[model samples]
Target: MQVQKTTIPHWSEDDRPREKMMLKGRNSLSDAELIAILIGTGSGMKSAVDLGREVLLLTNGDLYEFGKLRLSQLCEIKGIGKSKAVSILAALELGRRRKEIQTEKRPKIDSSEKAFKELRGYFTDLSHEEFFVMYLNRANELIQVKQLSIGGISGTYVDPKIVFKYGIDVGACGIILAHNHPSGNLKPSESDEKITKRILQFGDLIEMPVLDHLIVTDNGYFSFSDQELL
Candidate 1:
């Protein structure tokens, strides 16, 4: 006779994944354990944690890489069906949104590094190119960050008038421009330079300053002000 596999329900409370979570807390669980809670079960022989390990193993145990997986790719793992794959993707999307929400809080952005950190969170959900501008008070603290336009992977159109107009409407003293390079190229292209110049000209016309132009990506960022390109 074959021995039945031990299920999570059968394990003692502390040893059980869900119970372990309730007792200790979320941080107390490992990556695999957290995934196991999403899974709840596995193929006949493998336990939930085992299936979770397989999920991580498929992505080489990189959470960043894991978040980038397509739903169909996630379903490739044994015992992970359409429902489980959707759940995983939903959780990852929620995490990204949380980062964005945290950034929405007012923060002083005095340097390019600080601006990049504050603004990059807005780009986490973008798979294509989009432009944004951060309005700032005279003190260099952020007033608001607003999307200018969206485009295909190659580039985006940023109308200079709308950018500065919004800043004026919001009573901003200055603005910082930002856009994402979906190809992960941190270098600002020729068009990027031309647009920056155009916006700077408009800002000059109005006495509102274009303080910086940032080309940001998942890996890093490029800054016009830092390069003295402005």
Candidate 2:
């Protein structure tokens, strides 16, 4: 006869993490209990909750630090294999993306600093050049943000037509252009100035103004409009 496997169901329903989450709601669960549900199971002599507590201790009880852990680092915990580590990482990434999207949804861009604060998160971690554009309606409320190109550390080529196409597609009346400087330099290159002027001219013709051009770096940002170049 096969021996019956022991699992979380063997515990009282109140003590079972998944059941507690369903009945009492997710916010009712403790951090370890939530992690235990993600891990799903534990090694011999350790319950999932016990294993989760160990993992929390390893990260000094910080969820942000826990999210930064690599797969190899997580696997050092006895019950956390590649699959569990990947699941945790994927969940954390989704949470981060959702937060970014929510921040972009309805904010009006009234100043260079406000635009930088809203858009910097997208470029802060990048190691190469990336061109992004924020489409805005007449009220200066953001409609959407789009990545136009990815290139080497030196620069990226952005097609003005594609930028305008996205603006037209979204019914945008204005736009803000942004690009990152991997070397942490805030000064715009000659190519940057040239493109800004070209795009500004096009926007004027179409009655859709280029509100600003921002050079983002990990340290800070430079705005063309603030410098009186726009």
Candidate 3:
């Protein structure tokens, strides 16, 4: 009988992801290279690069889309079990926070256009629905932007009571409501109008006032207040 030889994985080399990153100066790397730096290693049949490629494909080229996926969804990829999925998500979130910290230097919101432009980078690529409350001072200076809820496109279930809590907590004198249409239309649905009416009604009671309700699509937005609807 002939003896069979087993092949060793190059990814097992001590200086793989880190060494490649240092040698290439980061910008020269592919998506798989950057992701492999975060993911560390792979299993028998798949290399770390292969696992990262699958992740990108599964997410349709948007890394933020991975945040919308369930752990079960990620585990369906051959080499990415729950732990690896968590690790990737955690690293991505950290990157988001770091980027946000750097964004603090950008000009703050003064007009509805400024507000939408500020929010577009975050909401543009979301796979699921999300609602945001952009708190503003009396002069329309940006105070804080809150993530009110993450739910289905039909609704995000904004409560007048909880919305008020965030307003009071942030000491906002006024607020602008904004949510994205994944369908890429700026038209406000019945649910969007309903939620806007309810929030405005509560703002009436609190004296904080609703500045606007902005329905954002990928390409543009409709402003309820600007249109004299709010």
Look at candidate 1 and tell me the lDDT of residue 3.
93
Q: TM-scores across all candidates?
A: 0.89, 0.68, 0.75
Q: Report the Cα lDDT for residue 168, model 3.
A: 92
Error of 2 at 127 (Å): 5.4
Query: What TM-score number comes out for model 3?
Result: 0.75
Cα lDDT of model 1 by residue, 1-230, tens digit: 98988877777888778889899988889899899888767777888888888889977998877877788888998788999888888888888878766444578888999999988888874679999999999898888889889999899998888998899899999999999998999888999999999999999999999999999998999999999999
Instruction: Supply the global lDDT for candidate 1.
Output: 0.88
- Kindly provide the TM-score of model 2 when superposed on the true structure, using C-alpha atoms: 0.68
The candidate that wins on TM-score is: 1
Candidate 2 per-residue lDDT over residues 56-118, each given as its tens digit = 887899875675567788888887889988877787777667646745258999999989988
Q: Which candidate model has the greater lDDT, 2 or 3?
A: 2
C-alpha lDDT score of every prediction, in listed order: 0.88, 0.88, 0.76
Which of the predicted structures, 1 or 3, would earn the higher TM-score when compared with the native?
Answer: 1
Off by over 4 Å in 2: 1-16, 19-25, 28-30, 44-78, 100-106, 120-129, 152-155, 181-198, 216-221
Lowest summed-lDDT stretch of 10 residues in model 1?
A: 97-106
